[model samples]
Target: MIFYHFGKYILLLKSVFRRPEKASIYKREIFKEMVDIGLGSLGIISIISIFIGAVTTVQTAFQLVSDLIPKSIIGSITRDSTILELSPTICSLVLAGKIGSSIASQIGTMRVTEQIDALEIMGINAPGYLILPKLLAGVMMIPLLVIIAIFLSITGGYFAGVASGAVTAAEYIQGLTTDFIPFTVTVAMVKAVIFAFIITTVSSYQGFYTDGGALEVGQSSTKAVVISCISILVADYIIAQLLL
Candidate 1:
């Protein structure tokens, strides 16, 4: 079953990456998708990122209750944890649910309603027309979102540390500036890109081949989210192993 689906996914990807019929039309579609997927998602991302960073700081501070350890380590720990794991992974997971399900349902609905068929009747490469722009948008915008998430998460940690009296503002700033590795940012970007691709492609595949009616569309959406999440985790582990 898995192999069958994987093979279909590969074939769909080949179709999606074909040359555009009209560069102007494709560009317009790409911009629209970027706004829909990126700007539309900012509010939820901001809320989750702030709370995740704050909680990480509080929890890390609580765990390191030792006189031998410097209080500034709370900031360092929170910074590293947020950048390395929390921001990219958690945010991608949230996006997989939000963006992935939307893609699946949108495409699935079009498939069921015969819109895709109508495009084909007009001599259009329906898959390329429908899915390519979304793929482009996902890859371009998700990394940008992750970058924003990283900054907001670190800021949240700083505020939480200072407000909780777990660490002084000066100590947090010092820790944040100390021993920062540029490579971690690269890893985060790599993860973000791979996750974005997985979310877009997997969900699109689920929707593109959807069978039956409205009930099936809902099923496809749910399946897309589930599959995208599992793919993200697998890709996350692989990227960490290779990059870190």
Candidate 2:
């Protein structure tokens, strides 16, 4: 069954990447999806990122309970943690719940209602028309969101550290500026793109293959989120191993 589903998923991806019948229409759809996936997600992502960074800083400070360690190291630790793991992985997980479920439900509903059948009857490339826009949008916007997350997280750490009297402002600033590896950002972006692809495509696959009615739609949505999350975690580990 897993092999069957995997084969189907691969075929669906091939369909999704097929050339569109109307480039202009696909472009419009891509833009709309970008707005929905990126701008619509900003508030939750921002709030979560800030708090995650703050907690990381506080926890790291709590752990390094020795006079031998410099307080500035807290900033460095927070910065690297946020960039390497917290921002990309956690935000992607959050988005797997939000955007992944939405995609699955939307597509599942369409499938159950025979909207996809109508598209096929009309000679439209249904997968390309529906999923391609989302794929492109995810690829474009998710990395940008991760970049924003990285900045906000570091800022949050700074505020939390200073406010908690855990580190001085000068120390935090110096730590943030010191010994920063530019390649980490590259790794983060790679992870973000892969995670975004997993979220969008896995959800779409669940939705596209959905059977039955409303209850089934909800089931498909749930499955989409679950599968997307699992895929994201697996991909995260693989990317870390290969890239880092």
Candidate 3:
């Protein structure tokens, strides 16, 4: 059974990658879904990013100030970590909890209702039609969202620094820029793309294989999000170790 499931998983992956970049047939429909995924999910990303930044700042500041480590290094450490690792990775987690589940649920529902089968009957490739736009949208939008996440996180760090009396605004800004390397942002964007692919692919796969009725769909959706989240967190560590 395990081998059989693995075989199915492999085939599913092949199906997705083999046609991931095909000219989309349902362009309008896919674009609408992309808009929903990218634009509609923006608010949650912003909130989570800022809040994480603030909390990270508070923790880092306390440790630095407590140890009497030169508060000079605080901004560099904070910004570098946030840009290269925390923002993109953490925001993906947030989206996994929020948007990932929604995608899984929506796709699962369609599957359970036989909508996908109907598409197949009409000579459409259900997998390609349903999953490609979402996949592409994930690729396109996550980097942009990661930028927002990093920015918000930095802004939160600034406020947190001021509130905690860690460093003056000028000093904090100066330190942040002193070691600011652009490669960190590139790493972040790369992470975001990986995360996007992970979330979309896992969620779509979960939803696609859903059988039975409403309860099964619900179960599939839950599993999709959980799997997506775990995969991303694990992948984040691996990617960070490799990149940073």
Candidate 4:
């Protein structure tokens, strides 16, 4: 089953990357997908990121019982955690449910409704036309969202620390700026791009081959989310091992 699905995914990718028939049409589609996937997801991403950061700050502060460890370490811990793991991995997991499921359902609906067939009948490269724009948009927009998420999460951590008296504002600010490694940001971007591709391509692949009606479309969406989440985690581990 693994090999079968893997082969199918590879074939689907080949079709999805084929040359576009119309550059202008493809550009418009890419922009539309960018709005749909990126802007549409911002609210939920922001909300989740803030809470994740706040909770991480509280939890990290609680664990540090030793006086030797400075309270400023809370800020540094939050910053590293948010940028390295929480923002990229957690946000991508959430997006697997949000964006992955949406992509699956939307394309699955079109497949079931024969819209994809119609495109093929018109001699269009249906996979390229339907999936390429989404792929491009996902790759481009998800990293941008991750960057925003990283900022919001760090800000949330700062607010949480100050409000709860877990750490002073001065200490938190000091921790944030001290010994910051630029490579962590690079690692986060790598993870974001990989996660974005997994979410878009896996979901699109599920939807593209969907064979039934509305009920099956829903199943595909759920499956897409599940698979994308797993893929994201696996990729996360691999990227971390290689990069860090």
Clashes of each: 0, 0, 0, 0
In model 4, pairs of residues that clash are none
For residues 1-244, write the lDDT of model 2, one tens digit per residue.
9999999999999999898999999999999999999999999999999999899989999999999989899999999999999999999999999999999999999999999999999999999999999989998998999999999999999999999998989999988888999999999999999999999999999999999999999999999999999999999999999999
Per-residue accuracy of model 1 over 44-93 as CA lDDT, tens digit each = 99999999989998899899889999888888888888888999999999
> How well does candidate 3 match the true structure in TM-score terms?
0.91
Off by over 4 Å in 3: 1-3, 17-25, 66-68
Candidate 1 has what TM-score? Answer: 0.99
Over 4 Å off in model 2, which ranges? none
Tell me the deviation in Å of residue 125 in model 4: 0.7
Evaluated at residue 16, the lDDT of candidate 2 is 93
TM-score of every candidate relative to the true structure: 0.99, 0.99, 0.91, 0.99
Q: In terms of lDDT, which candidate is stronger, 1 or 3?
A: 1
lDDT tens digits by residue: candidate 4, 110-164: 9999999999999999999989999999999999999999999999999999999
Q: How close is candidate 4 to the true structure, as a TM-score?
A: 0.99
Q: Provide C-alpha RMSD values for all models, in order.
A: 0.7, 0.6, 2.2, 0.6
Q: For residues 1-244, what per-residue lDDT tens digits would candidate 3 score against the true structure?
A: 8578668867877765554334655577668867887898789888877887788777877777455566757678779888887888878887777777887888889988889889779877777778777888888887888898888888988888888887778877887889678888888988899999998888888888988888988888788888888988898889888988
For each candidate, the alpha-carbon lDDT, in order, equals 0.93, 0.95, 0.81, 0.96
> Arrange candidates by lDDT, highest first: which order?
4, 2, 1, 3
Estimate the overall C-alpha local distance difference test score of candidate 4. 0.96
Question: How many angstroms is residue 115 displaced in model 2 relative to the true structure, after the best TM-score fit?
Answer: 0.5
Instruction: Give per-residue lDDT, candidate 1, residue 204.
Output: 95
